[model samples]
Structure formats: C-alpha cells, structure tokens
Target chain A: MLPVATGEFDLIRRYFTGLGGDGDGIDLAVGDDCALLSIPADRQLAVTTDTLVESVHFPANCDPALLARRALRVNLSDLAAMGARPLGFQLALTLPSVDVSWLAAFSLGLAQDASTFQCPLVGGDTTKGPLTLSITLMGTVERNHALRRDGAADGDYLYVTGTPGDAGGGLAIMTSGGERHNQYLLERYWLPTPRLAAGELLAGFASAAIDVSDGLVQDAGHLCHHSGLGCTLVWDQLPLSTPLVDEFGVEQATRWALSAGDDYELCFSVPPGRAAEMELAMAGAGEQVTRIGVMGRGISGVSCVSSDGQPFRLEQAGYAHF
Target chain B: MLPVATGEFDLIRRYFTGLGGDGDGIDLAVGDDCALLSIPADRQLAVTTDTLVESVHFPANCDPALLARRALRVNLSDLAAMGARPLGFQLALTLPSVDVSWLAAFSLGLAQDASTFQCPLVGGDTTKGPLTLSITLMGTVERNHALRRDGAADGDYLYVTGTPGDAGGGLAIMTSGGERHNQYLLERYWLPTPRLAAGELLAGFASAAIDVSDGLVQDAGHLCHHSGLGCTLVWDQLPLSTPLVDEFGVEQATRWALSAGDDYELCFSVPPGRAAEMELAMAGAGEQVTRIGVMGRGISGVSCVSSDGQPFRLEQAGYAHF
Candidate 1:
C-alpha cells in the first residue's frame, strides 16, 4: 500500500529520511540535494544499478516486501563480485497508483534490510507510474583488491557457494507445483541471501569472481570467455539440497542446476593449492563453498561431465534477457 | 519509441555502454556486474537521483527526445543546487512497448546532452514496463566547498537567473491554453536550459542555493525555511521577458512566476558585499542574473512586496506535488 495524495518530498521523509547506516568512510547521508561518500584512502568505490519492473522481473502480483528485498539484493550481488563492502545505496521508485498500506510494508521491509546490511539509504526519487524500482548500490574495496572477470588463471579451481537450482525449483513450484515444493522454492526465488561475506572473503583468494544470476553453466561460460580459459565441470559433484532431489528427479535437479537462474550464489575461481585454505576460511565463516569445476588452458567453453566422464546435456538452456 | 522485444543485456550495451564520460576518475566502466569509480583525492563526490514517469512528470505523448533531456536535466539540477560540477551519470529506462525508432531518437538526445555537458554516461539499466526513466548523476567539488541550503544569512540578497515564468506559461499552453499564447512557453518548459555555469560561478560567492522547480515563490520559501531566514520578494522586479508580458499580460505573467513550475533556473542568495562582483561575473559570462529579493531576520517565510516595501498578495501559489 502506498500513500495516496502524498507529495514526493513528504513521502521520502516519512519513509526514507534516515536509516543511520553510514560510518567511517561515508561522509554524508541523505537530506541534502545529494549524498556524499568517501572511499577509504587506499580503496575505490564499486557501484552498480539495477531496475526491476512488475510483470517483467517478477509476477504482477508479487509481494511488495519481497519485491523490495529482491530489488536491493540483486544490486548487492554486483557488489559481491567486486569484493566491495556495502556502504550506501540510492533508490528510484515509480508506481502506477498509490496504496499507503503497500508502501508501509515495502518501506518497513526496506528499512529492515538496510539496518541488517548496514547500508544506508542515501538518496532516492519517487514518481507515479507502473510499479518499478531502480537501485544503485555503492561499496568499497581496497585498491587492486577488487575482483575482475578476466583474472582467472589456468588450472584454477572453479567454486560456488550454497546450493544451486533452489530458485529455479522455486519458480517451477510457483507455476502449479505442490504446496510443499512451492513454498520452499518461492522463498528461494523471492528472498535470495546475497553472498557478501563470502565474496569479501574470496577477494584475496579468488583470481576472479561473479555472482550467478543467470544459470551456473551460462555464467561460468562468461568467466571462462573473459579469462581466456576453458572449464571442466563435474556434474556429480554439484552441491544440491535433499529437498531439490526429492521434489524433482535427480536428472531434473541436475538440469535445473545447470540452467536455472536467480540463485544469487557466488561463483569464483582460485589456484589449486589455495583451495584447502579457502575451504577452511569459508568453513570458519560458515559459508557453503563447493568446488564444482576447474579452469583449463586449452578449451574455451564449459564441459559438464557425468561421474563416468560422459558429457552431460540439458533440454533447456540458461535464461536470456532477450 | 523504444526497441521491440529487445533483450535486456543488449539494450543496456547499446544505449548505456562505452559512455565513460570524464574518465579521469572512472576506475571501471560498464560490462562488469558493477562499475567502480575512483573518487578524486582532494574532492568529495556529490550524488543525486531522480525518476520521471510518463503521464505523471510529463504528458503521455511527450516527445521522446525532450523527455530524455528532462530526465537527465532534472537530476543535474539537483547537483547544481550543491554547486557541484557535472561528472558522469547512470540511467534506468523502462518502456511499455518497444519502438526501435523511439529508442534511437531518445538515445541520440541523451548522448548529445551528455557530451554537451561533459558528463558521460557511466552505467544504467533497462527493462520492460510503463514508460519511466531514472537518472543518478555524480559530480565533485573541493572538500567542504559545497553550497548548501542551511547557510543563508540576514541581509543577503536573493537572486535568480534567467526568467521564471516562461516554462510555466509553456505548460499552460501544453494543457489547455491557446497554441499561439503557449508556443514559446511550451518550448521553454520542454527544453529548459540548466543553470550549470551560473551555479558553478555562484558556488564561490553565494551563501546558499536551490533550483527553482516548484515555481519561484515556492522554491524561495524552501531556501528561506531551510536556512532559517525570511525573504521579502519584490514582486515588481520579478523577471519576465517582454514577449511573455505581451502574450499574457503583466498580471498573468506575475501569477505564473509566483506559482508555475518547471523552470530549471538557479535561485540563490549572496552577501551584499559580493553583489557587485557577482553581477560582473555573470555579465562577463553573458548570463542573466536577476536580483529579485532580499533575506532578513524574521520568521522563516516568503512574502511578496512592492518596491516601496508594502506587502503584496499573490493570486496563486507554486505547484504543489501532493
């Protein structure tokens, strides 16, 4: 529910005036014409923006609270890639009509996330239009410590965090799957946990890192192509939850793992010898880091292999925005 | 017009990629999940964002090129309030339907203005939805040199640049007013000239500043209230072009100046001692700077007055967003 007949400035002040998340490096927060932030003396600021529209990015009847969460989390995923710590963010909202109740829930959800993440809401604008959200997130990383897509080296182990396919499975449930399956899967798709902690930890250990928004296979291909390397993926070794296998057959789960989207997981690559140390660090942080593949010198594409070394195939390809 | 069924990534690359305007501070441009910018060692970054919705901010059938200009210009105006110089910007565009030709025209207009202002496109997002555009602009200034709304002092002269009522008149012509009377007004309203140069110059001399968006009197009230000062505006000296007066008569023009909105001009205050030097600087730059009022020690409010210091009543107030 949004506020009807509420002016732009009042709406902003009532819902977004203060989250008080700024510290150390943030110089100024909201209230002025523009917010000001500072990069630590030896660091650069990582920034990314994303827009989500009703019926395009999510179902038309999507929950307002979840929509806000997903919108912010998607931008946070980009920050995760750069090994940047969340500092602050700006929001631009467009709505078809005002519904005060909806807005209250949305703002409450946004406020909770901002508090939990410690990223202040620095600036934003709201207008009347089809429900749309655009968020720009800012983060910081030490100079030269930011991860690059083209930095993966040959013989590096490709790793991923958490289970894959939960989000895709969730989507499937949404379209008429069982009550049990739908609830679990819907939660995965609607409320993804961004891998900020894992990403920051991997900054020094991983050669390159990317967040998996598209399917794992497609995203891995991006890393490989950018890094000028080929990858061999171990299908049997993929990390999957028991529920995923029980809800869908093993083959279906594997296919979803390969081609499903919206996992918000981190996929990265590190040298072979550093894998053990990285694993220990991830464990210490309670992160579920899984080694799924290895970067190779000669090939330029990803090859998914079965336990017997046979090539794996899927009927559906990864998601494409087109 | 926007592209038809354009894939999301391709649309972003086509419209927003490679803009790296004013690259001296850009650490990374588009293509990665997020962008990285290196804040200058001695300057602080000023950031603001704005969103414009079709049939809300502008008429539903407004020109694509003009709409694009307005979207960016409005955000730039916010930067001007802080006396920040243009740096780079990001855009988020959403459309109800794809019209390739419209996209081409809109992008061309945006690129032209971006280049003209020396502010390049740094990053943005595009998605399918009702027509809406969001822009976040970043600029820089010497540390603590930012002009804010809280610094106006008693006895300061309240000044404005260019004329105030043209755009308001144009808006009247656009909605229900006669075409002959509205032609010039509409043009001014649709294609506002941002007070970039004036703002940069005034940054050094002005005590405080804000852009006139909600009409002269309303915006003046904002400056006064924010700075905890009172303003007495000389209605007789309110700037009006001869053409406007001839077309709508002085009374109507005065009404428009008082309450009409959409004029992207600068309204600022300066100490009395700097008035002469400020006028000289503006004249040397071939710009129009009008001294229309004065700041004084009184309750924070705006009042219209005659040359003889008699209070005057206005027929209309500025546009109210609510």
Candidate 2:
C-alpha cells in the first residue's frame, strides 16, 4: 500500500504558493479566495482554456516534468496565435493519489515556463481523481489588434514560424523506440517553445493567424473556412528540419509536415507586398519564418501541389476528438 | 455499446455557443483562438477556479443539470467573497462518452445560471475523458476596495449571511436515501446560491471575508488563522432552518452546522459599531445575516460554547480532501 500524504490545502501551501511571485499587476495572490489582477488601462484581456487528460492528451507514463511544460505551452500557444502578451494563469490539477516527487518535478517545470513567458501563476485548485490538468490563461492585447481567423484576404501569402514537422517526427521516433535518445526530435516533442515574440511582431502586419495543433492542412482548412477563401500549399517549400529529412527522407518528411499534428507552430497570412517587411521585422527574433502557401478566391478548403505540379492526397487530414 | 455522437467541436457548437449571449464586455466570443474581454478602466479583475469530479464531489449518476449549476455556483461563491461583480467565465468539461441527453441537460443548467448571475460564458474547451467539470470565473472589483481575509480586527463581530448547515443536511438526506425528494434540502444541496448581493453590499463595511465552503467552524478557523486572531461561537445562535431541525434532531443539526461542509454562504467580520449599517444593507437581500461569534487576540482557531456556558467539542472540524 502507498503511504498517505498531506491533504489538499497543505499540499498546495507547501508546493505552489511561491510560484510566479508577486508581480506588479497582481493585487492579490494565492491563499485568498480569488486573485485580483489590474489589467492595464489600454489593453483588452485575452482568455483561453485547455484541458489534458491522461492517456488522451499524452502517453500513460510520460515524464511528469515534461508533461507540465507541454500542458502550459499549448495554452500559451493559443495566446501567441491571438497576438496577446502573457499576463497570468490559473491551474486546476486532479490526481488519483499523492506522489511527492511527481508534484515537485511538475511544479518546477511549470515555474520555469511561467518565469520564461512572464505569465505568473495567479490561482489554482487541486483535487483527487484520475490525473487531469486544466489551465485558463489570461493575456493582454491592444483593443483592435487581436489576430482573428477571418481576416485573411484572397491573395495573401501564408507563412508559418519555425520548422513545422520536427515535433511530429519526434513523436514518431519516441513512440517507435528505434532511436530512443535522438536528442533533437525528443526535445522538440517534449519542450516546444511558443512563438511569443514573433506573434507580437505580427500583430499589425498579419491578416490572419492560427496555431498548427491539428496538422498543417486541417488548421489551414480552419483558416480558409473562417476567411471564406481557398488555400494552395506548395509542397516542396514546406519547411522540414534537416534532422527529420535525414531520418525519414524527403517524401516521408513531407507527409509528416502536411498531415501530423501537435507541431504547435503559428501559421498566419500577410499581404503579398508586406512579406519583405514582415521578414525584416522577424529577422532578429531567432525563429525562421517560412512562406509555404497562398490564399485564393474559390471554395473554402486546402489543396496541395507537389513539385511536378500534380495534386497530392493523404489518408487523413489530422486528429479529431470524439 | 453507446451510439456515437458528434465530435467535440460539433458538440460545443450545437449546445454551448448560444449560452450567456454576447454580453457587453466581451470583445470576442467563442469561435476564436482566445476570447477577448474589455475590462473597465477603474476595475480590477477578480479570478477564481474550481473543479468537481464524479463520485468524489458528488454521487454517481447525479442529475447533470444540477451538477452544472453547483459547479458554477461554487466558483461564483469565491468571487462573492472578494466583493466582486460577475464579468464572465470559461468552462473546461471532460466526459467519458458522448451522451446527447446529458449534454443537453447540463448545458441548460449552465445557461440558466450564467443568465441569472449576469456571468456570461465567454470561452471553453471540451474533451473526452472521465466525467469532470472545471470552471474559471472572472469578475471586477474597485481598486483598494476588494475584501481580503487578513483585514479583521480583534474586536470585530463575525457574521454569516444565510442559514448554514442546510446543504450539509441536504447531503445527508441525499446519501441516506431517506427523504430524498424533500425539495428544500435537495435543492439546497443541488443549487446553493452565492451571496452576490450581500457580498457586494459588504464591500466597504466588512473587515475580512471568506466564503463558508468547508463548514462554519472550519471556515471561521480559516478567517481567524489568517487574521492572526481567535474566535468563539455561540452554539445556540447558529442559524438552522426549521426543515433541517425537523429532519435531524437539534444535536445532530448543530453538529452538521459546525462540522459538515459544502455551505456556500459568506462568513465575514465587521467593525463593532457597523453592525446596524450592515444589517440595514442586507435586510432586503432575501437572506438573513446572523451574528454567531466575535474575534479576539489569542490562539488562531475557533472554539464553541453551549447556551449553558459549557465547552462543546466535536469529532472533527470539517471535511478534508485527500
């Protein structure tokens, strides 16, 4: 039998109180019934919520620390897509039993991301049940500058930040256990960074944006459906990391790039003439921005063309939760 | 086997999109990567989150509609304790399978409460998992006026809005399978109302405030611990409804009032001379304010005395989550 641990209140006090320390915007913090935050006068609050359940979102026995980072990062990626600056977040964590080491590592990873992104942990709830995590993150964006999915024009160039297929390739590598210690792919899978800086820079320039969570094609379909436009992707120009290409070859890597999900990179559209200006703005942001497609007036969906100008087809678009 | 329903996104669009219909402060509603809220310039945002799990927070097979109301109300009670007015909320709901009838009933209760409390549903996430409901509520309070748990003075009078222990008695009746259809007790358990009006009125008058979630005595001990003071409760003065007394004898009802949990009322402290003003403020609010104790400088916990001036002790202070 497992040893009994301290109750919920004590566990929270011992582990979670000192996180995201008393920042200027927080009028009240943990230990209170509700946290009070002073939103800056000129900014509107952007809120998003995401929940990860065991075995559904992640594998059954994934590392606790890495799970913590991925959970928070996915929510942060939503803010990035909306062109919002991080403010703070609240966590609701449910567990089947108390495990001190797991809690310690999880909180450490959460604290690291919170500090790095400047999003403090304002308040949270911990309960007993099957392991599940729910995070509601709040951010700030200028009143009319929030990037929407319906703003793309008929002839805009579609661009994505960072390499698109590395995380998906990494997930495959981790699951197959062929090369268990491939540092690049494993790290990409475990610790994908949200493109906060590029998102902020894209606020005034990009016409539309979305994070690629459910494959490039499915998410592009989302953009087209909302904007009432059709999208065409040039298959050869799809960004692929050298490691992924080396491991899986060009054809397989392209498939992963187009059809695999959980990449967490931002895909947005800019007016064709402003591509150079957007490129110059992102030059010093340390992320490579790739123009992979173009939007057009027609039916509202995504189509792919290979280097030889032939249409490409795949088995499925992306993941769907039912 | 159960029949397959629509996917997660379709389910949300079908049932939840029309809830809490586009309110004044919401700049962006459901269909976006993030919901945008425009906070008033002079108001601070008050935030709180809570999660309820199946078979832990409530019995198995409980009514979905009632569970929805209870989940949202408990979070609203936290905002009420901070003297904040409702702004909006985001929900993260998890379920074992797609049950159309269950989803319809749950969303109905949620929509009803969202309308009544003036807290609209701004954003949410739905996923497939074991039954769980998590809500994060946001509200607004004036700067420097939000109540805290550390503001009580040594001589402040401790008061609780509404009769306590009814929910506990209701829970007892529910679990015992006797008098299960008693509307008053069952409704008290299923739809505990947050003291929003009283809390808003107590903003400037109450010294320290907390919502009585974990029984009266245990929650009072929380106030005393935070305020660096001690409290003494007059056992006979505990406000017990006639129905609760009739169902359970006086001694058992008193025990429930002291140690049973899940009472969503406001327990607060007011200065000695402001009782009359506080009473006048709460007179027409549809709930009685009962003064059951006083604060003093001593050990930080709560003690009770019988009407005959003898010490009264119970087996435990309140419910513990472990």
Candidate 3:
C-alpha cells in the first residue's frame, strides 16, 4: 500500500481522484491547489467541520467503514441545522501506519456516504500521525434563508425527527454482553441518517433549529440558550425506538433518548400554527416528525415533564467539548 | 493540566469562543452549533485544510507557540496558491492533556499571526487524543480570477518569493549534530509566513501559481507537469538565506534551496509581457520576487542550470506526502 506521506499526488490519486467527482456544485475537485465550488445563484453556502480521534471520540478498533460514515454524517447533521443541502466535503486524515486493508474499507465507507448523500469529495490532506479524521462539509441553502438557533420564541413547538435512544441502547448492548455487532444497533450507532430533507422542509417554517448531536435535552438547551428562551419538554412525546423500549423499558428509554449523543436527528422549533404544515411536509418526504415540547420565555434552560406531568431531571446534561 | 475530554466547555470557551468572531465575512462565529460565513457577493471562497501530529509532523516536545503558528500557516499557504485573500480559519485540536499555560502561549502565537495577517479564527473543535491539530482555512478571490497550476504555458517565466530552504535548514539542524538551536533557523521552521499578500498580488498577473510547501523544484515540477510543460531553472539565481549559506556552504545550500520543504512562499509563472508588471506587483506588496526558471515544452520535468549553463540535477526531487 502506498503511504500518504510518500507523495500527496499519489495519495490523492489513490483515495480521492476517482471518487465523489460526479456531483453538482463541484466546479473543481481534488488533486488541485484548492477546490472550487460554485454556489447556485440563489443559494448560500453552509460549512461545518468535525474531527474524530481514535480512543477519544471512538474506539480504536471500531469498524473502519462505519467510523468513516459516522464522521461524515455528523458533519452532514450540522448542515441539517442550517437547512442546507450537502454539496461537498474535504477530509484530513492522519494515521499511525499505512494499513491498506483498513484504508480500503475506510475509503469505501467514505465513498459510499459521499455517493449516497450526493456530496462530492473536493480536496483534503493525508498525513502521518495518531489516527485522526477531520471532515469539513459544505452545503447550500437559499440566500438569507438559512436557519439560525436564535430564532426560537415563546410558544414555538419543539419537534424531533426520527426515533432516538437506539444509539444509546446500542452503546449499552455493545459495551455489555448482548451482542458486539448487532447490525441494527451498530448501524444506528455508526451510520446515522442526517435529517436533510426534513431540515430543508422546515427551513422557513422552523423557528430555531439544531441537530440532535449531543442529545435531545442538551441540544434543546442550545437552541433555547442561543435564542434566549426556555423550553418545556413533554417526555411522553419523545419518539423512542422499539429496541430501546424493549431493552431499557419506557422510563429508561426516555431518559436515554434525552441524554444519548450521536443521534443526528433534527430537533427544531416551529410556530404553533406551522405544526400541521410540518406534518404535511414530513408526509411528503415520507419521514416522521415527532413533537417533543414547546418553547417559552424566561431564563434559558430546559425543563422536562414525565408522562404524569411531573418535572424530570437528568444526572448528565450533555456531551461538552473542552 | 486537564485532559481535554475532562475540560470540554472551558477549553472551547477559552481557546475558540471569540477568537475569530470579528472577521470580515463571518456571519456567525463559534459558540454555535456551526459557523456561518458569507462569501462576499463578488468573490468565491477558497478552502484548504491540513493536520499535524506529534512525533510525526513535529517532535513531541516541539515549541507549542511555533507548532500552533505552522498549523495554520501551512493551510494559509494553500490559499496563497489560489491567489485568495485570507479571511478566517477553523481549527480542530485533539490533545492528550490540556496544559493551560501551554495553550495560552500557543493561542498567543496564533493571535499574533491572526492579527498580523487580518485572518480570524472562526470555528474549531477541541477533543482528547494524542496531540493533533487540524486547520481549515477559507479565503476569498474574485470570481474566475484565481491562479491555478493548470494555466501555465510554454515559455512562461517561473518565479519564487523570498529565500528558500530556511525551514529545511532548520529541520536539518535539528536532525544533524553539532549545531546548537539557532533561534533564526528554528523560527523559520516553526513560524512560517504565509504569502497572502503576494498571492493576492499574483492573482490577475500570474499565468499559473502554487505555494512552495514541498520545495521549489518539486512544487514547480507540479506546476510544469500539470501545465504540460518542462522547466529550466538557473540554479545560481536561486535565493538563499545568509544563515543557510553560512551553515551549509554554497553547494549544499543550493541543494537545500532546491529540494527542502515548508517554505510557504509563492512560486508562480508569468508571461514575458507581464514580467515587469508582476515585478511591480511584488514590489508593491513588499515581498521578494526572484526569476528562477522558464517553462518550455519538452521532457515535461524540471531541470536546473548552473551559472555557466550546465545541467543541474539532484538525486532526489522534493518532499513527498506519501
């Protein structure tokens, strides 16, 4: 296998040249000094980046393909926040050694996600180091219409797309003895479906938006805090996966749904009247849009109510970056 | 010292929160789910990223301040290739532990460059890992006016900015015996100056351009090879630093100037008619511009000629990424 440090040209040809080249908004792709992107006349570009490190953000021996997809997906989930369409992304990869099989699998995973998501690989750098991957994603949204977290207001309804807590349940199972490689849970933990369509559909309708990366409650707190508003969550309304309920029970599943990271679901707030419109949009996209809570004015924080309408609190707030 | 995974929020707040918030085209800054940037109405953004790892890219005990500066400067050099104006950058740092004092000094050096170059720190991710730093920079250029290596033509004059091989000289000094830590050489290796002003000046004037990160001869080879031309270098005209000449002698200094990397200077081609104009541009920017070679159609590689016009060739070409 060719090492990236041997020559950048060889590395580019081997891993990126043939992949992610056939996509829109990519004026110039990899193997160039810098990638050239053409933003559509009426669209604005949105960019987000995330870095995942071995034994820190993920396990050292984690599935290479799945890890690649997850890293890109997390950045895509950020695009979902701005209601942007994924255009392309650049990756910076650092590895301790030149392991061909691992690189093949990892590149396959990245290529698969890029194709599936219609995001081209534009440019990147590969270097020698402790295993690390940084992906910078670019997306497009209507000019001046990108979603912002400071748009939430009192009386807005909070909604989350898709089921949550499956990832948390998967983590529990993976860490324990049930199954080290349950396809469904592992897929949930690794290959997340970034709620792009739902976010695009919610662009003008949603008041404040954020992806459920850190967790439902934690991300909700972000929206509220950024918008300078408080939010009330109806725990009974949170969408929990069947596997989560079966494994952890409804109460524990709800708690997990509130605190688990890596969900990649969109948690957004819409005005009360637009709730029905959001449902219609979801129906058109063949996706679920579950209402979870309501936004309110006051000190910026999150409050949760159980099935019986009592206040609920969690021991862990969210995953924080230092 | 707090390990990054343990001091998440505080680290982000201290290192990233408001660092690049006041940049020219930044729509939104850090402390959000994702950064928002506005590509100027008449310009396109040039994006590039690079990652450095401890013990691989640099020694584990490398000076923190210098390491931080190079982490961003190298990426800026990529922007320089595209003839883009430095706007801002994002950093993703993964460290085993957070030494507050070290981070402070590192940030101080970063701020010095940021302030000097008018580029701001817009966003970044901080995590725990074996020490690694990835920087993604965004710059702006007038639509369709960016310099590219693909635009070079036969008979174009090749030019390079400033002295070459100081960084390589510093690296050699570090690896070789007998030479104590020379502050000048060491600083060159560590705190590289990105040729932003020079690049902007070359935007409309140069036929093709690239920044010398992988030595002049090798990188110029890229410009020539990509442009389907061969290049002839006048070796005696090659620029060198006083320290490099004093330390390595003329022949070795010439070799280092030809083949060493990490200079972060611009190398470009200009039509004969535009040579005087290009010189004025370089002069206006207060950067050294030296004519080193000429591009021609032939073997499609680089060759150096001595003052007497004899062929000059090295056993090896330049830095290979691998």
Candidate 2 backbone overlaps, count: 1
Separate DockQ for every predicted complex: 0.42, 0.51, 0.44
Cα lDDT of model 3 by residue, A101-185, tens digit: 8988988988998998999788888888778999988888887778888998899998999898878777777787655445676
**What does the lDDT read for residue B33 in candidate 2?**
86
| Residues B1-322, model 1: lDDT tens digits | 0011226656666766765355667777777777778778788888899888877788787788888887778878888888888878878878776677888788888887887777778777777778888998888866787878878999999999998898877887777745465567777888788788888888889999988887788778778877887888888898998778888898888888876788878889999999999999999999899999999887448878779977656655676454
Q: Candidate 3: where is the Cα deviation over 4 Å?
A: A1-6, A177-182, A298-300, A320-322, B1-7, B174-178, B313-315
True contacts kept of each: 0.53, 0.66, 0.47
Model number with the top lDDT: 2
Give the Cα error of residue B133 in candidate 2, in Å: 0.7
The best-first sequence of candidates by TM-score reads 2, 3, 1
How much does each candidate deviate from the true structure in C-alpha RMSD? 3.9, 3.3, 3.3
Candidate 1 scores an fnat of 0.53
Cα error, residue A293 of model 2, in Å, equals 1.0
| Candidate 2 positional error at B33, Å | 1.1
Q: lDDT by residue for model 2 over A64-166, one digit each (tens)?
A: 8899899899999999999999888999999998899999999998888888888888998998898999999999998899998999999999999888888
DockQ value of candidate 2: 0.51
